[model samples]
Target: MHDESEVAVLRYGHRPGRDDRMTTHVGLTARALGADRVIFPDNASQSEETVEDITGRFGGQFAVERTAALDGTISEWEGVIVHLTMYGERIQDVEAEVRRAHRDEPVLVVVGGEKVPFEVYEAADWNVGVTNQPHSEVAGLAVFLDRLFEGRELEQEWPDADRRVLPQASGKRVVDADAFGDGDDPGGTDADGGANDVTE
Candidate 1:
């Protein structure tokens, strides 16, 4: 359960695929990591569920708003603002907005997407290839929030590489025959380059 305090999270991606399952995942992950309130900045016309829906699913603990306005100081916010996608022509404006938000508060800006211009990269705190990579992204977000709230620099380096894929086991040899559940199991491949048929 999250505390009643507010944690601001700004998501800039507005396209359908951009805010698809990844956006929902981000919201759920933030709540699970202890964010009482999440402020999502939708800079496009694509709308997701309303704030009411978000609050209902999250126990009335989250807020979602759509706007292009970047006025006011973001230092008033208690948490970080992460950008899931980058803007096209208004890249400079986005950087300016993030800077304003970071001014007086410990902020964490995630730079994802392909159009990450040199300027934006120079301004961002951390950069990662895949924003939709849930596990690491969520954990990094949680760490950033904790560090920001604690008023300390992140004790580690910025996450700069793409999500690493683990090697899959070939499973060439069967360890136990009885472990297989009752089903039409596909037999292992034979050395003759053909499927081994399983017959009664």
Candidate 2:
């Protein structure tokens, strides 16, 4: 439905111990949900590694980066900046407009933590709220991307994947990409607890 114009996610503010998994999910969500890349805060190297590791096994062209210049990144960003917040304008009202604008330009989506600085609100081309209520940034981001792509991401194929999940009506089943031969599923990573969908 759209041309390639790069959709990137930037996570702002992080408390190492408190936000470890939350921050990691932000990157993972971005990668799985069709964003081209995710940029983590400088102190989030561990999160970067975790996201990269997932991409390696599950497969995609997703990239993970870390930056110390967050403020500058937003202020100097070349394309639209969307900041997700509970206090912002409702997402349903603005997603169509955001989608049109993003068609020809890169979109940098900002997901903040407990307290986003005032400058972010001002710098944003759009201050969007998935729901104007309390919730996780990961939820907000996931919903936003699904809407942005109009559910096309669910049909996305992962290239160069070492493993992939075969959808089942009941129990989980994962398979090695190359080992499926003669109608036999000889390889399995689901034993390692890898499933056929996004990690929750």
Candidate 3:
């Protein structure tokens, strides 16, 4: 199995009103899609809190951290730095090479939230573009992660969740830990429905 922790995401240049929601989605997507952690280098506290809440409720080892010096952080990260941009090599063409090269090393995927500096482009070990067109950063990140994990992320089990959503064709059907049979209950709920409280 590919260790999701091998991949991390860095959201650079966060602006308050402008990039708030987008940056939050970037961090959430990174965690949900199988990244070890996310680094918000421009002080996205709200986003950090939301991600923390989600991880706390759902049970994940994923992490989120805020910092001010993104360039300096990237400079010190002991892994490959991949910047997602529109002006770089196509993701499909370079993903294979990237996987082979970083097979045994960690990967830090950089997603820009605002106008990026020229130094960022130079700092990256690989500048990858999902498409050479205007697109959502969230979409690019999801696609990149999907490619990197080769769809394994979709099958990942959330063992710590109090309530889990079952795959459905239409309507929503969430399975609380209390609903499962003894052997099936990963959360070890009792017959009295001793499941963890589903918080807001």
lDDT per model vs. reference:
0.39, 0.85, 0.78
- Model 2 — which ten-residue stretch has the worst lDDT? 189-198
* Candidate 1 C-alpha lDDT tens digits along 1-200: 23223445544343565555454545544444444434444542323353334334224344455445322223333454454332222332344444455555545344232233454444444333222334344454555455334433222211221111112275343211232334322333321222321110
* Top of the candidates by TM-score: 2
RMSD of 2: 2.4
Native-referenced Cα lDDT, model 2: 0.85
RMSD of 1: 14.4
Better of 2 and 3 by TM-score: 2
TM-score of 3: 0.86
Runs off by more than 4 Å, candidate 2: 1-3, 180-182, 189-200
The residue-level lDDT of candidate 2 at 140 comes to 97
Candidate 1 stretches greater than 4 Å from native: 1-6, 41-47, 50-54, 69-114, 122-136, 146-200
As for lDDT, the candidate ahead, 2 or 3, is: 2
Model 3, span 1-200: residue lDDT tens: 24533888999888876677788888878888888889996568888887887776566678899888888889998978899998889999999977875677889899988898999899998899999998888899999988888888777766666656555476544556456443343433221222322211
lDDT of prediction 3: 0.78
